[model samples]
Target: MSETPHEYPGQLIEQVRTAAAARTPLRITGGNTKAFCDEPTRGEALSTTGWAGIVSHEPSELVVTVRAGTPLAELETVLAGQGQCLPFEPPHFASGGTVGGMVAAGLAGPARASVGTVRDYVLGARFINGRGELLTFGGQVMKNVAGYDVSRALAGSRGQLGVITEVSLKVLPFAPAEATLVFELGQHDALEQLHRWGGQPLPINASCWVKDDTQASAPNLLFLRLRGAVAAVEAAGERMLREAGGTRMDNAQAGPDWALCRDQRLPFFNAPSADLCLWRLSVPQTAPVLNLPWAQLIEWHGAQRWLWAPASAAREIRAAASAVNGHATLFRAGADGAPDLARFDAPSPAIATITQRLRAEFDPSQIFGQPA
Candidate 1:
């Protein structure tokens, strides 16, 4: 029998497989806050809390290679020291989300539009396939693969693509300063504003719309934040304000607010009700007057939004998402939510097929978390 160690279980991969080989259903966890995810299965629950550390950091080369278990906060801290960061700017779950969990889940925040998505920044990875054997693919260099690179396939495959052991990513130097532009607009106009600004070649990094279910005055608050060199960020901010009319918020608080907005990991940390639903909504900005059916807390220039509804409201949320040519998912169904409502989005056909094939390639034995 494999012994689990204190503080951390070093041979986490082995421990996970041991459970799987026994035909025991395994639930993978990190931070364990989003544990309510609708996916099903049971037997032994495994934690990667012990597998934490940074293997290497090449700030000058704009690369940071680390153990899968490292906390995103820690990694970001180190990157900030060097004025560098994960360009995609993924969200750190309120319960202290880990880097490994970040990659396995392929989550990104507001910076996605301008900087690129999580899959874009991943350069390489080390993981244990379903067979319990360690595997490595891609490398330190970006644009290394000429064809299918297994390194990136791990993104969004969930934990079904074996357990990721190490991660290598391409980072970027941080700008000297940044500023945010906040404005209130109706849902109908917000869609227009998003389309207008998203089209310009501005240096905007993150844009979002905050919507209230009641559709109060300026029901949707549109926020645009631009960053770069001190002069550059300010210049872009000024130009954007001139081009787009909006009230500006003190950017000093923008960092924390951005974190809270993207992951709902903050401000909503202790929401008043356990019945709150957090969703990631994707829709077309060009679409005219989107008839958003449910109550939503939107973010990321309306590209990504959160739907707050009753646990039984998932079917409607899914339908609304479909109408917008987008999708919604339940990372947290609410305080008292349903298990089946956990999965909120139906990926595009291409993404769906790719996700499935990746599961097969990485976990041929079909032993990870579930059948991909």
Candidate 2:
């Protein structure tokens, strides 16, 4: 069951048309929870909060169609009532996070490595193009292949292409059981163990490795989560405890910890120095420990690494990631802020050309803010 649909595509289209004709850029916003994630954009504010509500939800069909401005928490709550969930675990940085922001940011939570990314679940989308034309792509089912890739590409576009009005997402039922295990290991050893366990038939859903500065006695910690059938979770937990050497944590205790990690509420995310910027390095899971000297928090089975360093270290940090066939993003600037620092890695020449062409086609007047 869903609430009454709040359809405001007409108003959004008119707004885009006015901006396009006037050659004025429009900054798309929904809850503005992730406003700090990207470089600042200057434009007339185009808010989507008025265009909200769930259009449809079929639990048995494993799909939900929702208006872009609907709150992320509201959608999650509805799914929970149906014993379903967004398996990628999109992060709500703050209370007012919206579905549109989630799709635009394309950020997944702890289960990303095991499940997939935000783009993987985007089944369909309806957006207003720069010309103020309402365009729809993909569909509510996986079998609908027409324009499917286009819909998925919009997941991380950050409003460069268009204003997303509504989207249909694939959902999954909650796992029957889940367990969390913690181990005492250094960064290298934890990465090795994660790689080793990754090869086996285990139910490892998510993992995090961080130095618990709050607990001086036991600093290095690796927290692993398992999800699946009751028997499989139990078996995997027991085997991990015996082979890996760790303690099983109570769900009541571990659940909030996992949420904290997902939403970046852990102490490791806090900047110890006002000048230290937060960098997110996306590298291969098999990549060895980086040689950089900075505090780090490893996630997504070692594929996603977070570090705190000054903007001056940007070159070195990016070079290290590139050496391992990866790229790094300046996720957050320092408290004083580094406006000159590039927030994202530069795309290859070919990709850059393609991106330019796409932007020209979708937003010929350049009425939308720059791409993320």
Candidate 3:
């Protein structure tokens, strides 16, 4: 596979056309911020970075359209100017993160449990398929459902089915008020309290729990974010404090703290050394503290958990997650890439069939790398 000399959107089609004709695989690359997300791929590198810029924006209508290669930060800055935001809070992991990578990764931030995920905000998309044909799905508005909503399906496809060219996303108004509160409690108590508050009318936007691995006797810290009307946030803060002793975090400190967690800049996410592997588990919020032999950090009110352990512990780690009806992934593998381990859990037989059929329909030539 060789790099195509063409640079324009139409030229991109020609590149794919040539590849399809030759039956050669082409690996799509954008800001290159998410290379660690999936198994290493092979093929000629097709760069989307060259096709970058916002296409359209309607602040009053709360919608923005942009080229897939547009930088995520640039789009966010544009939305912020209009008092709007992409509430999903996708992580960049590195500079040069693009809108295409954001949608392809389909990762939502702390607000996800309360607001929505990336797929929920995706309105429409245009992509060049394996046959070198361009196709558009869905539309700018929120309610356009004449045919199958393939736009949302492409949200997390990771460029497998096609090369995303443009996208339309629903923007949300920035919250008028916000506050963070910290509570000290054990993991079990924190989980119970999270469930209790989850069932109430309190404006709980996000919750995170961190325990000290070095000192088991130390109490865990539960951080909660409340947002909405100023009065509502104040009232919710008062109620939460009454439930358990808590200290209010300065509004100035809350923003950076949340950003750190979103980007995994906190020490909690570091492996301490390159030898350790990082595992991510998605389970029921009410599930008990996992009985595993690794340090853990709870987020999304216990719906998402992270741990750093040796690659050799993969089996025991996955078993613990499965016991709770959850699934685990080797988020960041060790030096060897966890050769014998599955990065993602296997889907059911029926689901595998449906997925393969869809892949065949969109990419008959298999010009993109196989699924992770």
lDDT of each structure? Answer: 0.70, 0.92, 0.86
Q: Each model's TM-score, in the order given?
A: 0.86, 0.97, 0.95
Which 10 consecutive positions of candidate 2 have the poorest summed lDDT? 1-10
Which stretches of candidate 1 lie above 4 Å from their native place? 1-10, 37-40, 146-148, 211-220, 265-273, 340-342, 346-354
Evaluate residue 113 in candidate 2 and report its C-alpha lDDT on the 0 to 100 scale.
97
Residue-level lDDT tens digits of model 2 in 142-243: 999899988998998988899998999999999999999999999999999999999999999999999855566856989999999999999999999999
Ranking by lDDT: 2, 3, 1
* Best model per TM-score: 2
| Candidate of highest lDDT | 2
Model 3 scores what on Cα lDDT? 0.86
Model 1 TM-score is 0.86
Per-residue alpha-carbon lDDT of model 1 for 99-193, expressed as tens digits? Answer: 88888778787888777788888888887776667778888887677332678777876777777877888899987777888776776677677
Clashing pairs in 2: none
What is the TM-score (0 to 1) of candidate 2? 0.97
Q: Rank the candidates by TM-score, best first.
A: 2, 3, 1
For TM-score, candidate 1 versus 2, the one ahead is 2
List, in order, the clash count of every candidate structure: 7, 0, 0
